[model samples]
Target: MEPDRDSFTSLEPGGDNAIAVTLGILGDEWNLWILRHAVEGAKRYGDWMREGAISNSVLSARLGALTDKGLFDRVQYAHRPDRYEYVLTRRGADIWTVLLTMWAWEQTWAPPATPPLPRMRHIGCGEFFSPATTCGECGAGVEAHDVVAELGPSGAWPRSVPASITRRRSAGAKQPSQVIPHTMELIGDRWSAAILGALFLGARRFGEFSERTSAPPTMVADRLARFVRLGAIDTEPNPDRPDWVSYRLTPKGVAFFPVVVFMITWGQRWFRAPEGPALIFTHRGTGHEFRPRLACDRCGEELTASAVSIEPVAD
Candidate 1:
């Protein structure tokens, strides 16, 4: 079914503008998990339960919320009592790139939790390429050290001081600050990242997450609960199965895209698997890897951290 774009993307203004707009729709942990499943084929409640292992009450709430938001079409698959299956609408499918970016980020910076992640064979070139992002405009490779940021008219920082930034750029430490960002403290653990990445890659069932992440069931359940509480994910009831539920992403949850893409480009620039890059993602038609470039919307010059300045909005 065609999804109403307005339903999912209607933005609200508040603190930090875009981030705030994204946060209103975003929930913590399990929301993205559910959407990941929907993309992969977990249409019925039982399919979700068996896969995500979410509680009954929580699942019901999430399903209703997602349907209301128009991310999923609650299509009636059965007639006896009008059984329904939660299917992904166009807006929902758009989240796949966010998830895909995470998967690539995980493979590159998140460390080797398991032996070679599922290989991504580029259909055009028939070689493994890690998923990557390029500038939507100029198509230059984006890197963390190269970009500068400042508030747009709609954005305001809470403080009026110069932003001080510090980072350790090493990928070798088990708990290296470079590979793991503060944002990932909750979901950064390999297991949670793997689970989220799996969902984005279409592994919905709990068993599938386990297999994909090579984690035990207990670990999967633990991370799922953590994600749900953090408001990064949500759940819903699956109608066709009657006994199961579904999981889906909130808009706020989908807002994690920029972070994922940033990390992916960072990984691409810095860390590489000992054997080599595990996978590569290329354009379907062009077969060229994503080369992200960042330039000013107006002047169109390449962005550089040294050349940029940021100041808090005066209160």
Candidate 2:
């Protein structure tokens, strides 16, 4: 169901905070690509061009735009040659978590082979990693059907009922709740998901992101701004050039990488492409692929969307 835009309130009542800002920054494909490259250690424009073949104008614009949004730091590596490099800030590094999650999804659901890519394994145990949803608190596995979606404090709720619901009522169907909230809303857009995929592959510059996703510049800029506001990235001053800047993910942002890994896994399993995954992650210790699963830290149980419920604390 569509969210109630009227009732939804911003996490920051008056304005966007770090989280909102970061979200705005990473929301776009170009910005995301810039982040991706930074993650992969792309510092020079030449490096970005060689990797992605993006237009110079588009790349320049995206870099400048990301700098303005605080996602990138530009530093002059050579004054005489007028060469510069980009780097990620603490904030930018944080977004890796999100990228990891998306990668996991793509690997599982969108496999290049009919039998699917080789199974991911735990680096420590040498056990094949299986997809499981567990509770965040209890560590118990949860299923999609076990949890119910509800409107959160930050979301807009309907001031009035939608015409479709009202019409359904007229036809004798039960009127659903006035509010509905789900985790999917946090990362629902196809573009957003795809952008996260590119980031997982280490595309940190606009050109690289565009090359991977083929997204438009304007849209990429907008999304990158969202990610900035969301606190997913940090802009830093280039050490060599005080006037230039580079972008990176924050710790919080990096934590979201697991979400990307999960997404890739899902995509590979469910949505195969003519070609295989651009890249695959293997367990460094186990010599096996890593398939991430979400589980509750407290109980080690898998967490599913339907398995948990939230209640507001008393004021």
Candidate 3:
């Protein structure tokens, strides 16, 4: 499926919503990497081939999809065979902040199996900096504990983001939980977020996680180790085999529920489907959809961009 006509052209028929559509367009396993490389100056077909290990067919498809999504505009640099280079448009450039947040998260909480590449420097500050998300209304820190539920239209919603509700069966409602800056490293994108999402949905073993996400076994194992280190999950012995191990989300890992739910909310609004959402979250046994909110813990207002601001990093 493609993004709703609002953002990009229809790539396929039937979508759950905008989140599904956008993910369909931009959330492919290799798509974001393509953007990251483009930002760093990789353009030629061969350049992608050499560095990204992408096959021609998949690369071609993703390139077309991204072009349709308005991120990349192609420029014909060659004439004989009409070869072209893909360049970033303003839309493409805009996603960099999302990427930067992910990079900051990886640096802080989820280091790769190999040593990380060179660090990012803020040109203005002339120093390596870790990015943070803060309340626009107040300079106070944004944590899980600092937010509340301001649900529905009385609650302000972004022009784009739709509301998310979880566990329809429960009489109780859910509030947007605490999310510190470092937590961005964990839930901002697919791999890390997908792991948490799958675990929350009840996949426990290594094989189960591998099956649930696009991540390969190596990435899964690496991230599981990182999560263990971060206290998001704990290892439990398999009863059938003493040597076999399974992973479960720690309480801290469980706290990431709102982030995944919000992704669904945001995706649904932007990536609309003809029929309905591709997937929905509900409580086990009761089978109720959950409704979630992003509220301010301080003034208890519905948090919006106009109401939030980033705080200066403490020296």
Question: What lDDT score goes with residue 183 in model 3?
Answer: 55
lDDT by residue for model 2 (175-263), tens: 21111111122243534444554554455666555665556777666656666765665667767667755456655455455554444
Per-residue lDDT of candidate 1, residues 1-315 (tens digit): 433643433222332232222222232335555765666667888877885347667567777777765668788889978888888766565555544454455555445533233334343343444444345444654443233332234333221111211222257522311122324533444555556645544555556666656667898888877767756568777665657655555443544445544433333233222322322334334445544543433344444422333221232
Which stretches of candidate 1 lie above 4 Å from their native place? Answer: 1-3, 6-8, 12-16, 24-27, 111-119, 157-315
Cα lDDT tens digits for candidate 3, 1-315: 433333633323431234434444443336656776777677878877775456787678778877776678788998988999998766565554445454444445444423243355444434445544344344433443344322232111122121221111235432112123335345434466557656765788988888766577987888788788888789999988889898987766655544444545545444445544544543333334444444443344444322333222332
The whole-model lDDT of each prediction reads: 0.48, 0.45, 0.53
TM-score sort, best first: 3, 1, 2
TM-score to native of every candidate shown: 0.47, 0.40, 0.51
Off by over 4 Å in 3: 1-15, 25-27, 137-139, 148-231, 234-315
Cα RMSD (Å) between model 1 and the true structure?
21.1
User: Whose TM-score is greatest here?
Assistant: 3
What's each prediction's clash count?
44, 146, 34
